[model samples]
Target: MHMQTKKNILFLFAAGVMLAGILGTSCKKDAAPDYGIPTITRVAQPLDSASIVTGSFTQWVIIYGTHLGSTQSVSFNDQEVPYKTIYASDSSVTVQIPRAIPKDVTNTVTVTTKGGKATFSFTTVIPPLQLTGMLNEYTAVGDTLILTGANFDLYGLDTTATSVTFTGGSTVNIAGGTASTLKVVVPASAQPGPVTVKGIAPLNISIATVAWYWDNRNFLFDMSNFNGWNGKTYLSSGPDPAPVNGPYFKVAKSWQGGWAWDPFCSNNCAMPAELVNDPAKYINYALKFEMYTPLNPPALPLKLYMVFNSGNFKEFFYDAGGGSYPYSTGGKWRTFTVPLSSWGNLQGFTFSNPIIMEFMLKDSNPSQSNFSICNFRMVPIN
Candidate 1:
């Protein structure tokens, strides 16, 4: 054979061998073996052995079983539960229950792995009870107290089964209730402290502190009627132009170097005789009022003066310009509550015989000075 032909034949043989090797490697496969269905032995806390039949939303739980190492997904109540794979193991998987569990469905936790899925049944409850506020926090014995909150079992689902107890005292009488409101009469012996309400059947408890008093009263001034304000000039009066619509008092101040306006309520304004006659009963009280400015005013200092029958006075200053108080209504009305205790010793001034209530406004800048006031009231603290 010629030398060139021999070389050509050898090159062709080598190329054929390389092609066969490439084909053989491409056809090779190492697929994972199929394991049998996974088994769920129990559901519990990660570090504790106590099994839980009911859990709140957004709670983390542990699933113990066989062949959970390859868990691909998890679901609660047939709804997909987002999870992380780092906590999955051959015998256990840790997952967080979905935060938005359907309120109307039964709860079932399902874990899916490479082998199969395992499901466990349980009850899922809503978020824990929260106390928002009260319609009236100050009440005397035999008075009805209205409490507002979430998940209170208020609808008389089991009238005799639900119980309300005042802390450090006996259970008070529950007059009526709904999901968000509970009406209870303050017992004569009930002390000033936290009140706890527990529901029936699937029991849930919520607690709130109430201010109870023997001589509780609300001295309300609905600024809509300005007849009682003596010798005071209001720039105008009409329906509240702000977002919180109601009757309001409008006072305008010019840029003055000193306090320019003082609005005073005369001593003849009707006040509870007990509040003025008994010093002990008036000690525990608070003053609440609503104030609004077209916008958050700059830090203009405003003062409240409590004039006494003895010619003595006490003063509390708040930044009408939204400085020190750190609270803003954002063009809405802002309700302020000042505890009597915050005023310290009032220089022996008798609160029961207050002669006047005055509002002082001072502005130094050229900007228009304006604000509205309403709902001035004094309420017992406890």
Candidate 2:
């Protein structure tokens, strides 16, 4: 009986050992597959596909396949990329790239990882074209055009630019933005159809289609702010000494110089006047006046004295029939052109000082005479 009991115990122990071995093997088989430390299989980045935008920023390339947790960082050129969100369980990292890299045929991206280092190359592509401001569909020929755009060289509009070109014989004056804006003039040669302007290179797109106005004068006349003369100040009526009609200014009258009605008095004289902000010095030197002869003409002969800064009025005196230049016969408006040459050549007066023109409407016969005055404009002959 003792022998039998020992044998039973031995058999049971052996069975228990076998059962534990089988269960351990099953657990090991059902566990999980091991993909060995994630690896970088030929890391790469989008070729220089960066695009230009009109706003404050631009878009750039991104790298892929730098291995999981092995990747320490992804950078452009050499600048460290600030940590952005990691995507897909360590598969990739999405980041905002910088534009400091110089544009060229090829750019570099560096990916550093625990596994190793990999470099990718891409060519920077030109950005797409876009238009901004002034979206009028139609622009007429001979109309002044102000084109607002971007990406142009500073030395004026490049006629040979591949992206954008002018349709008509238009002339564009460019200013502001290093090489980005164009102020173009619409040409008369352009046809009435839809005219197109394109920006070149990266941005090859049409900006605007301006309609041509056939008659600009008629259009301007209909405008409420329209005036026969250029936009300027005008005084038509006030006191007796003022001009006789609209579009006239009392630059200098007899009241200021005491030359109101008594044409013969020394004080009743018109003074010389100089232009305020004349660019061309010639405009400042010469004097021009349009006058209308009054119905009650002055009986006394009047002389207009053009005095330079040097007090030399004798040299510029107009010769009347009797050693006195007479005022108009008082009937019609007449245009008088006077060249500074008539004044003894003193390099004409400087624009800094006002040209004092004294009108000596003195009546030699002591008879009171008067006349009406009109507009005056002095333009450079050149």
Candidate 3:
């Protein structure tokens, strides 16, 4: 009986060992996943496919190559940017360059994926200087004028690296300003011409050559070379209401009428015209004139019509709709601009001789006729 029991115990041990081996084989871990190597061939702008090798900071770009869909990290010039695996694909990855200023001067973009890493030659370009506008174009001497735009700090614009020149070839001193605005003190030498600006190394810009101050570029009737034709008038030599560069045309005439065609024009002043003697080119220009009306002025403004020339074509000093210019300076001299192109709707139009401009009263009942007009000129709006 003892021998038989020993044999039975040995058989049971062998069976148990075989069962353990079968369980081990069934529970083997799954093969490790296959992750392909990643590489970047080039960078480009999204949608346009424009191969952009270099770009400014914070500009969005696409990395094109193989094995990028599993991107784990992206860096421009060693500046790591926030990225996601979901937004990436095996062929391309869209990312934005970080806004932070990079300390690492490595002009290359590095990308790392589950498979491998890639470093692409790329340069980060700085923002360039751009000019927009000059504030208070008619700034008096010693007064502060501002230049408006972006990236003023980039150039360190001051009296040193930046310059401000007026139309007549006079430059002003910088008064200091912020990143988007530049302040300058207008010198006594500032003339009436296009404003010019210069900055460090290849930064030169010119603006407003024909639009700011009242100039003599295309002067017409300013009560000097060309006087008024007919109207009760006198030149304002001034103290009261202040004197302009020149006296108002036949200063202050009492205009009283009820929708009547009252006349005021240059008796024999025919302009020299613009652009190769083509007066039609005046259409591109702005007709500017200084006008003054006494306090509590007219309900409807003055009219310039071809009543003596063609009768159908007419324009207002302002865009007052046909002959309904409701402009009033209220006793202070103010410049009025009338874009000649605004008259494109006036049929039967042509710039030629017999340019008899008849200024009429447009009110059903207008006040006195002593309105002043001077410095008629055609200038660019710039």
> TM-score for each prediction?
0.43, 0.26, 0.49
lDDT string, candidate 1, 121-216, tens digits: 877765645554455444446877666766554223225456678756679657777767778787877764557766655434445544332212
1 or 3, greater by lDDT: 3
Q: Against the true structure, candidate 2 has what lDDT? A: 0.40
- The candidate 2 region of ten consecutive residues with least summed lDDT is 214-223
Q: How high is the lDDT of residue 169 in model 1? A: 64
Q: What stretches of model 3 exceed 4 Å from their correct place?
A: 1-162, 174-185, 198-208, 212-214, 231-234, 250-257, 264-266, 292-313, 320-333, 345-348, 368-372, 380-382
Off by over 4 Å in 1: 31-217, 220-231, 235-248, 258-286, 292-314, 319-356, 362-368, 380-382
- Alpha carbon deviation, residue 195, candidate 2 (Å): 30
lDDT of each: 0.60, 0.40, 0.63
Predicted model with the maximum TM-score: 3
Greater-TM-score candidate between 1 and 3: 3
Best candidate, lDDT: 3
State the lDDT of candidate 3 residue by residue for 7-108, as single tens digits. Answer: 999999998899899898889987866778888999998777988889886788899999887789998887887865225888988888875546677999
Model 2 segments more than 4 A misplaced: 1-285, 309-315, 319-330, 353-357, 362-367
lDDT minimum window of 10 residues, candidate 1? 208-217
Each prediction's total of clashing residue pairs, residues at least 3 apart in sequence or on different chains, is 4, 34, 10
